[model samples]
Target: MLIRKAHSGDAQRVFDIRNQAINHQCVGHYPEADLAVWTRGELSDYFIEVVANTGHVAVIDNQVTASGLLDLETGQVDAVFVDPACMGRGIGRRMMDYLEQQALQAGLSHLILDSTLNAADFYRRCGFVGERIAQYQSPRGLTLACVPMIKHLAR
Candidate 1:
C-alpha cells in the first residue's frame, strides 16, 4: 500500500469511501435515520478544498482504499475512513500512522478527533484515549454521537 497526499480529484473517491465505511461498518451503532442523514449528499466544495489541503489517501493496487485528514495547525484529525471492502486489512492503522507522522513532523504534540461509535475501539487501540460521549455536528447539519478522543504524541 502506498500513502500519498490527496489531490482535488481524489475528493469523490474519498467521499465514496466515507459513505461506504459509514454504511457498512456503522450498522447498529447508529440509528438508520441518523446514518442516512450523515451520509446524504454528493462531494461538496468544502470536501474538495479539504482534499486539496489536509487530505491523504491510501492507495492499494492503484485504487484509493482509505483516506484521512490532519489539520497540522490545530492537531486535529478531522477524518479517517477506509473502504468497507478494505476493512480489517490494517489500512486504517497505516493511514493513522501516516497522519501521526505528518503531525509529528509539523511539531504537533497531540492529536484530537471525534470518532464514530463503531470506530472508538479502533482509535483506542491506536493510542487515543477518551470514552465520554460527544455530539458531532456534521457540516450537513446532522448531529451524531461520537467519542471525543485525544492522543499525546511522543516526542
Candidate 2:
C-alpha cells in the first residue's frame, strides 16, 4: 500500500470512499449517499473546496482504500474512511499516521476529529482521547452529537 497527497486524478476513488463512509457509517454522513450522487467534476470541486489541506489517500492493489484530510482550521482531521472490505487490517491507523505527520509538520499541536459512534473505539486505540460532550461547528450550525477526540502532538 502507498499513501500520498491526493491529486485531481484521485477524484473517483476518493469519491467512492467518501460515499461509502456516508452510506455505511456516520463518520461522514447523516443519510446515505446514492450511487451517482455526485459527478466527477463535483467531486473534484469538493476535494479542492472542503477537504482542508487538499486530501490524503491510501492506495492498495492500485485502488484507493482509505482517505482523510487535515483541516488547517483547528487542525481537525476530517473525512477519514477505509473501505469496509479493507477494515480490521490497520488501514485506518496508517491513514491516521499520514494525517498526524501532516499536522505535526504544520506546527499543529493537536489533531481533533469527530468520531463516529462506530469509530469511537478505533479512534481511542489510535491514541485519541475522547473530549466528551463536545460540539462541532458546521455550516448548518454547531453539531453537538458524536464523540469528539483529540491527539496531542508532542512538542
Candidate 3:
C-alpha cells in the first residue's frame, strides 16, 4: 500500500471511501436517522475542495482505500476513513502514522480528533486517550455521538 497526499483528482474517491465506511462499517453504531443523514453525502463540496490540499489517501493497487486529514495549525486529525472492505488491512493505521509524522514535522506536541463511536477503539489503538466530550450535530441536524481524543506525539 502507498500512502500519499491527496490531490484534486482524488476528491470523489475520498468521498466514496468515507460514505462506504459510514454506510457499511459504522451503521450499527449509529441510529438509522443519523446514518441516513451522514450517508446522504452532504459534505461533498468540502471533501472536493479542501481535502485535496489538506488530506492524505492510502492507495492499494492503484485504488484509494482510505483518506484522512491533518490540521497543521490545530493539531487535529480530521475525517479519517477507510473503506469498509479494506478494514483490518492496516490502511487506517498507516494513515494515522502519516498524520502523526506530519504533526511532528509541524512542531506539534499533540494531535486530537473527534471520533465516531465505532471508530473510538481504532483511535485508542493508535495511542489516543479519549472521552465523551460532546455531541456533534451535523449540518443536516443529525446528532452524532463522538469521543474527543488526544495523542501526544513523541519527539
Candidate 4:
C-alpha cells in the first residue's frame, strides 16, 4: 500500500466512506437528513477545507483504501476510515501516520478526535488517551456519546 496526500477528486470516496460509517454504525450520530446535510459537498464544506488542509489517503493498487485529515487549527482528526475489505491490514495505522506527520509539521502540540467506542482502543494504541466525554450532533440530537481522545505529539 502506498500513502499520499488526497486531492479534490478524492471527495467522493471520502464521502462514501463517511456515509458507510454513518449508516452502519451510529459513529456519525446524526439523522439521515442531518448526515446528508453535513456530509453534502455544498453544506458542511469540510471536503474543500480538507483538501486545503492536511488530507491524506492510502492507495492500494491505485485504489483509495483508507483516508484521514488533520485540522491544523484544532489538531482534530476529521475522519479516519479504512475500506471494509482492507481492515486488519494496518491501513488505519498508516493513515494515522499521515495525519500525525501533518499535524507535527503544522506545529500542533496535540491531536484530538472524538472516537466511537469501537475505535477508542485503536486510538489508545496510537498513543491517544481519553480526555473527556464528548457529544456529537447526530440524528439523535446530542445522543452521540464518544470519548474525546488526545495525543500529545512529541516534537
Candidate 5:
C-alpha cells in the first residue's frame, strides 16, 4: 500500500471510495433515504478541489483504497474514507497514522474531527474521545448523525 498526498486528478477516485464506503458499509447505521442524500453530490467537484489542496489518499497497486485530509490551520482531520472492499485491511488506521504524522510535523498538538456514527468506534480505538458534537445537516436539511472527537498528541 502506498500513502501519499492527493492531486486534483485523483479526486474522482477519492469520491468513488467515499460513496462505496457509505453505500455498502454504512447502510446498517443509516437510513436508505439519508444514505441517498449523503452520497448524492456530497462528494462534489468543489470537494475534489479541496482534497487536492488538503487531503491524502492510500493507493494499493495503483488504485485508491482510502483517503483523508488534515487542515493545518485548524488542526482538524477531515474526509476520511476507505473502500468497503478494503475494510479490515488496516487501511483506515494507516491513513490516520499518516495524517497524525503530518499534523505533528506541522506543530499541531491535537487533532479534531467529526466522525460518522458508524466510524466513531474506530476513532476511539485510535485514541480520540468526545461526544456527539452535532447533527450534520445537508443543504436540503437531511441529517447524518456524527460524533465530534478530539485527540491530544504527546509531546
Candidate 6:
C-alpha cells in the first residue's frame, strides 16, 4: 500500500470510506440515531478543502482504502478512516504512522484527536493516552460522543 498526500480528486473516496467505516464498524458503539445523523450527507466541500490541504490517503492496487489528516498548527489529527472492506490489514496503523510522522516533521511534540468510540482502542494501541469522554461538535452540527486522546511524539 502506498500512503500519499490527498488531492481534490480523492475527496469523494475519502468521504465514502469515512461513512462506510462509521456505518459498519460503529454499529454497537453508537446509537442508530447518531449514526444516521452522522452518515447523512454526500461528499462535502469542507472535505474537498481538507483533502487539498492536510489530507492523506492510503492506496492499494490503485484504490484508496484509507484516509487521514494532520493539522500542523493545532497538532490535531483528524479524519482518519479506513474502508470497512479494507479493515484488519494494517492500513489504519500505516495511516496513523504517516500522520504522526508528518506531525513530527512539522515540529509538533504532541498530537490530539477525538476518536470515535469504536476507534479508541485502536488509538490506544498507537500509543495515544487519554480516554476522557468528549463531545465532538461536527461540522454538520451534530454533537457526537467521542474519546479525546493525546500522544506525545518522540523527537
User: Can you tell me which runs of candidate 4 are displaced by over 4 Å?
Assistant: 22-52, 138-142
lDDT of 2 by residue, 56-147 (tens): 88999889898887776579887788888888788999999888888888899999888766688888988999957555554324343578
After superposition, the stretches of candidate 3 with alpha carbons farther than 4 Å from their true spots are none
Full candidate order by lDDT, most accurate first = 1, 6, 5, 3, 4, 2
Instruction: Return the TM-score for candidate 6, rounded to 2 decimals.
Output: 0.97
Count of backbone collisions in candidate 3 = 0
User: Where is model 1 more than 4 Å wrong at Cα?
Assistant: none
Question: What lDDT tens digits, residue by residue, belong to model 4 across residues 33-60?
Answer: 6545544544246665665456788898
State the lDDT at 26 in candidate 2: 56
Model 3, position 72: C-alpha lDDT score: 90
Clashes of 5: 0
Question: For residues 52-121, could you state the per-residue lDDT of candidate 3 as single tens digits?
Answer: 7688999999998999988899997888999888898888998999999988998999998889988899
TM-score of each: 0.98, 0.76, 0.93, 0.78, 0.93, 0.97
**Clashing residue pairs, candidate 4?**
29-138, 29-139, 30-138, 30-139, 31-139
- Candidate 5 lDDT at 123 equals 97
The TM-score of candidate 3 is 0.93
Candidate 1 per-residue C-alpha lDDT over 12-41 given as tens digits, one digit per residue, 9 for 90 to 100: 999999999889988999999988998998
Candidates 3 and 6 compared: the better one by lDDT is 6
* Candidate 5 vs. true structure, TM-score: 0.93
Most lDDT-accurate candidate: 1
